[model samples]
Target: MITVSAPPPPPPPQPQPPAGHAAAPEPARGRRWPTVVTSLVLLALLMFAQSFRFPNDSAVTEPMVASGDASAAVDAGSFTVKVDEVRFAKAIGDGAEDSGLSDFAPETEYIEANGVWVVVFMEVTATEKQLTTFESRLDSGDENVYASTSWLYNTFGSVDDGFPPGIPIKGAAAFEVPEKALKDPVVQMTISSGPGQRLAGEAHVKLGLSGDELKKAIDGAEETLDVPAPEMQKV
Candidate 1:
């Protein structure tokens, strides 16, 4: 027998994976820390860079304020106002005596003050168009923000007093506050053309009636001060 059977052809070489296809060794648990640390450093750097910049202007939500003394004319964009006098009164009116109101009313109208009445006489003028509404607020270095009292509706000053363009409406805005509220009293007048008045122009009239001057006003308060009736004529 020619037992010369050709040596079985060497088994086909076992299929070999390409060099790039070799299974990658599992990464050491500690090896991931460098990548995590690098990511953290980048995030911290981003936050640090932001700290050097000033605050965004849009975040300033305070209204634009125009400040002046009692006699000075303060321009509040839509309207200009000039405060003439500030009076402290024990009572506003009595049906027998003058009510400080122009119109006469029956049934014995007497707007007596619980604390004291601070009347601010002012002339308001519209800059662009006729404005029918305005507002006043009192800041007396206290917790309470006193608004105009409704008790003096018939008095010269109305929250919605009409102001024509270029013309002035002379009236008085009244606030009833305690005698102690005289110190550092500031009255703010607000006018707006639209519905919302946020960031709008405001007039901060500094009545030189604080400190020693404040005491004088309290001492010289009228028994019954008369608030001139609101009229179109500028006084």
Candidate 2:
């Protein structure tokens, strides 16, 4: 009998994809745009941090006696009497909102000297025109007596009652310095008839400082507050 028929021809080998056709591409390294951008950003931030620097504040000049005729008066020995530049500028606080320029014409403030506190107010023309005119009339004359409409002496008693009537005004009556407040240095002056009111007229005042020294302080303040005198209606 014949041997078993030969096994069927071997099945053809299965087809395989070409070497470069199907294998997953190797993961691209250092080619990521996002990663590169992120690295650059970090470097930039580091450089920026290194460049920053802080500023330092300068020292303040000490108070000095302003040179002038010792006997000069600022406002008839009432509001101001002397010129002490160092003291005048220092009267303004660091946090004060006003540039204090307006103070040159129709403004007032409180100050201290020789352990005394005083309020200072200058009554210039209350109107805008008067305010402008005042800027033109400031100067350093010894006998010049600029007439202030009214001036009041602030006292320690007023500190308690907030300035009662009977305070002296040169044009109206002889106002006396209360014995109780002889040593107190602060005084108040203003343009309004009352405290915290809009200025109705040109006026100014000084408090606390006193004597020849007080006069000198006001004169110094005048240098800072040299605005033209505002025109006043004739009586």
- CA-lDDT, candidates in order: 0.74, 0.30
RMSD of 1: 10.1
Question: Model 1 over residues 64-152: C-alpha lDDT tens digits?
Answer: 78888776898978788888888888888522335565255454455778788998888888888866557778887665678976666
Q: What does candidate 2's lDDT look like per residue over 1-235, in tens digits?
A: 9899999999999777567754434434435767989999999999898766323222122112122222343332112223222133223211222456655534444232232212232222222211111111111122232221122222111221221122322111111222223322322222233333232222222233456664565445422221122112242
Tell how far residue 117 is off in model 2, in angstroms. 19
Over all chains combined, what TM-score does candidate 1 have?
0.65
Clashes of each: 0, 36
State the displacement of the C-alpha of residue 168, model 2, in Å, after optimal TM-score superposition. 20
- TM-scores for the candidates: 0.65, 0.18
lDDT, residue 89, candidate 1 = 87
